[model samples]
Target: MRENLTSVSSLNMAFTDSMKPTDLSADKKGIKRKNWRRRIGFLLKTNSSQPILRLVKNRSYRPSVDDVNQWAQSLDKLLGHKYGKAAFHIFLKSEFCEENIEFWTACEDFKKLTSRKDLVSKANSIHEEFIRSEAAKEINLDFHTKNAIVQSLHAPTPTSFLAAQKKVYSLMENNSYPRFINSDLYKELCAAAKGEGKHIKS
Candidate 1:
């Protein structure tokens, strides 16, 4: 009976030893899964927080226009208003031609740079990303404008992208601006603004 009992104890010890590696492996896998979940959660949290960042960085202030008629009166007037710029940007994005406005805005900022170092650096980056062949955000340009920009690259100035920028601006003014003025989004904004004005007057 003693020998039988000893044999049972030995079997139990062997079983426990065999389970150790499997149990450890399962624990490791569980930890890995938890870490993966945590990483995904972190990414989701970061992505969700971006809108809050935009809110903080971009002022909530909308240009107050007493009359919505001003927007329809002139494209220049519409382009000058903050709401108009935002609406136009959205429209450009919808059309997949956002690079036109983006390039134009970049040129505006580029012209404001005081440092030659910054000018050179920004010019190279902009040219590569938006003007070079098969660029990620290449803007449509005539051959003359393209050639001018390529020549300017040899000695980049604040106005290195001026020709290209002008072309993009013209494109927006002639093409996108007309569409934006007629878009449902613009109509909605106009309606909302008019409603706000009426509410205030009352």
Candidate 2:
């Protein structure tokens, strides 16, 4: 059985390799052949890994307003992933309060940097744009948090934005988050997800 399975896998690999395009010509025939090869290769790869890929693809499912609401019921669920952040951003944009989400997202991304140069550069950028007074898209932060960020800027580290980021997070949790849960947009999304008419409102 093991030998048979190995032989089948080798055959599948050989078939996939045979479909790869060899010619790089600019003519229609060459282009068509290349496209055909790519399509076949894609189909074979997807077919081979369908079970695992299905679960990964499902993670990317776009949530409706009701889905968002259910997620919002848990703070960790709402703030844990980019999907939640993106949904909140859309809602904030509609409400003209997008800066909060923007600042929060920037902080999240900033923490993921590995290079010292990038950390310093992004920290300064975040401070100038969101934490600095009279700056465009300035985030609402208390003096203590702003002062700590300023101090961190003098000797910027990966955690330089921690204080400010926390403040923005708390602001969203206490303020915009609740409003988003109850907004007309959330209701519409929930209704749409349920296959109801788009005009339905909560």
Which is the leading candidate under TM-score? 1
How would you encode candidate 2's per-residue C-alpha lDDT over 1-202 as one tens digit per residue? 1112112344233222221123334563444333333322322232343322132352334345555566558645776744455445555644446788778779889989998888888988998888899988798888988988888876677788877778777877888888767765455445545655333211
lDDT of 2: 0.58
Indicate the worst ten consecutive residues by lDDT in candidate 2. Answer: 1-10
Poorest lDDT segment (10 consecutive residues) of candidate 1? 11-20
Clashing pairs in 1: none
